[model samples]
Target: MRRPTIKDVAADCGVSKATVSLVLRDSPQVGQVTKQRVRESMARLGYVYNRRAADMRSQRSQTLGLVVTHLRNPYFAELTMAIEDAATKSGYTLFQGFSRDEVPQQRRLLETMAEHRIDGLILLPAHDSRPEDLLETVGAGQLAHVLITRSVRGYECDYVGADNVRSGVLLGEHLGALEVSTVAFLGGAEGSSARRDRIEGLGSGLRRSGVTSPLALSLPAIGDEGGIPLVDRMLERIPCPDAIVAYNDMYAFGIMNGLRARGIVPGRDVAVASFDDVPDAAFQQPPLTSAAGHPEIVGAQATRLLLDRFEDPDRVPSTVLIEPELIPRSSTTSWSGRA
Candidate 1:
């Protein structure tokens, strides 16, 4: 027997194929009587709707892609889960990829997603990504996209992320109140907007307490292996840094490891703080002090923004910023001693 299609269901129900298609899509515009008849006919005929064929007809892929810089980082891992949860709840099947902190990889992943005809995208661009690069790969406003985490230099689009500047300021204030004099900011070498805002916030917050300048130790990478060189250079060059502000918990962990090897425990000597209070931050040997970005909330916001854009493409672009909270822990001050 031949396979059943919308046409078959329509004929059996004595209705038009358009009505069957509307019912298949769960469109609310169809009347209740017609909707019931179409579903009944589909059940009687064992008609299965082909989503791919319907997508082709409507020029919609029925898929959305999410691309972030690196999933190895716990912050991104948590953020990804939140996005996935929100996307699934909104009835979307997602395509996810990472750029591996490489520009070519970012371009390739985006181009591939575009080829798959993704209806929209949420991007956490790599350091090397530029507005022109994105425009070339995805086309100029062709694929509805939202820039999350970090916005590209010249690409004006919807964005959602934690307030990096305020987070930095809050972290800095935590350290400043603890009387940290000589501090250093490690990792985050790339010239992304988030990096710039964070650095400025740290400076602004610390300056209020008479700590005018902070030594910026820009590292090429923020992995555990890279932490050793960063520690070595910091110790040799500025041995008296009272505190260290790492880019994220992942970097803070690496720095802590490096400090321990040099007989400098984090809580007792040379305090450390981080952003994105990841799962491990709370359980580290000396719990890491951090600014909580609430990655899940940010992810959910991004998902909502993307979904909203899909509904109203002509809507004006918007930016959503969530402020982070400073979570004090053993890494910055003695866990038990802190009042």
Candidate 2:
């Protein structure tokens, strides 16, 4: 018995092999009805795509290389999974790496992927990645790349993330509604674009509500381990602060733990809020008040952007900032400012 090929699928569906190839690549150029017919023909005829052979002929690997700066944070974990699901469903392969928010390590991993001929790259920039560093390392025209969550030195490229500033605004409004006048914004590093936008949004919201400027406390970056020590440092400021707005829900969880260690009860003694309503945010000791980044949506959108760039590399770059939603819960909304 002989194996059925892309040509067989094309013939069965009465379309040009070029069209069949596009369908196999999940190219958006093909119409839905035709896509369905081609898919059905492939299934019926048991046609298998020779991706490796195709790669050899085209000199392009059908693989996307992904580097997420932090992996232990469940938010990034969820985001990575979403990208994987979208990539697999679209018939592309992915190679994922964690840079642990280190610039040299991220550059090394990305260079290694490029050396292997990865067709594209998806990156969550490290704490100190310059746009020029990336273009220099990978070569501007070498691969179709997309920036996710954080942009690098404001260089234009396919990018997607929750509106951080808007999310900060959402958190501030929630705190103001709770009559919080002096909250401390905790966690994200000083120079992160995401953190800057968040601080801007939060400041704007707090000021509009007659609240004073928030104590902008900085951490090293967004990850698993900085919340407790950072929040402790925030406690040393002149004013004890009305509430705490963490960089993300993971940090909020740590703040809650830290508060408990200090013989203070969160949500009752001081309110708490943060961004990225990751799944665990709700199930915390007291459900968290947070802004939803919709990692699932943002992740899917990032994947589509990269895949589209693969299909049409010359298209103008796009930046998609998904709006965030505030989830008010016991951790902040119910705080009475005393335990």
Candidate 3:
């Protein structure tokens, strides 16, 4: 069977080969009418563009590398899929890797992806990652990259992520309206930018509502522990918090589990809330209250920033923060002592 080529498409569309090539490249010079005609002709001729041949001629890979922290996290998982979707639509193949919040692992992944000659990279930096850690791969001009969801100190790049500070403020205000006093925060590793921003915002919101600042505990490592052990530590404080705000839904789930283990119902005994309103948040036993980060939006925006950066390498770095909205559910609203 003979494969249809650009020549056949051009012939069918009554356009020059150059015009067909322009349409294939999605150049702005091609008008919509001409593009439509070319596409229709392509469909009729079963013409498929040879992206690999085009890449070779252009000296480009047409490939992108994406490294995210904690792929198992539902929010991150959703964000990754969204990024891939956006990249595929833009005619770029995405290679994905999970860093698991480790600096060494993340550095290795970045180096490995760079070796493939990717056109660009999108990263969610690992906990405590320093700018120097990426010097050899990204900082050395080997590849252009965008930061997503997390930022590293001294590393400036296009970034797209949730407004963690706003997320915490929204959560705090909601809890304050419910008359929840003496709140505590659990989960997230110490020194994470997201955690620091969220904690700052929570404190601001609490103080604005005449509530005292929250007691924050940064876990050294996040795992299945789910803040089970922190329950006792919080209880032992001078005044036990009536409510807890977790770093994210997963942490909230763990705290809820721990509370249940102590014969304490999340909504009935102590209010619980968290960030990132993943799908499962609404289906929990008590239905968790959460601030929705909208990872899909973050992912899409990050891809846009990276694509734009590729188009204009000399442009200044950009940062986009998608605002979060708090979703109140039984977890916080059903606080037994709410007055």
Residue 335 local lDDT, model 1: 27
lDDT of 3 at 220: 31
lDDT of 2: 0.81
lDDT by residue (12-56, candidate 3, tens digit) is 889766567668788776789999999999999898879886775
Task: Give the best candidate by lDDT.
Answer: 3
Give model 2's TM-score versus the native structure: 0.83
Against the correct fold, how does model 1 do in TM-score? 0.80
For residues 1-339, what per-residue lDDT tens digits would candidate 1 score against the true structure? Answer: 999876678789896554566677787667799889989988899888786776764776657899998788888988899988877765567999988767899999999998888878988888768889888877474788888888777777898999999998997787778777777877764577777777778878888766766544544454334555678777776664788888778778888999889988788777888888988899998998999989899998898787766545688889999989989988888722234
Compare candidates 1 and 2 on lDDT and give the better one. Answer: 2
Error of 1 at 8 (Å): 36
lDDT per residue (tens digit) for residues 226-316 in model 2: 7787767777854456788888887888889988988878888889888899889999978998999998998888887877666556889
- Number of backbone collisions per candidate: 0, 0, 0
Model 3 — which ten-residue stretch has the worst lDDT? 215-224
Per lDDT, what order, best first? Answer: 3, 2, 1
TM-score of each: 0.80, 0.83, 0.83
lDDT, model 1: 0.79
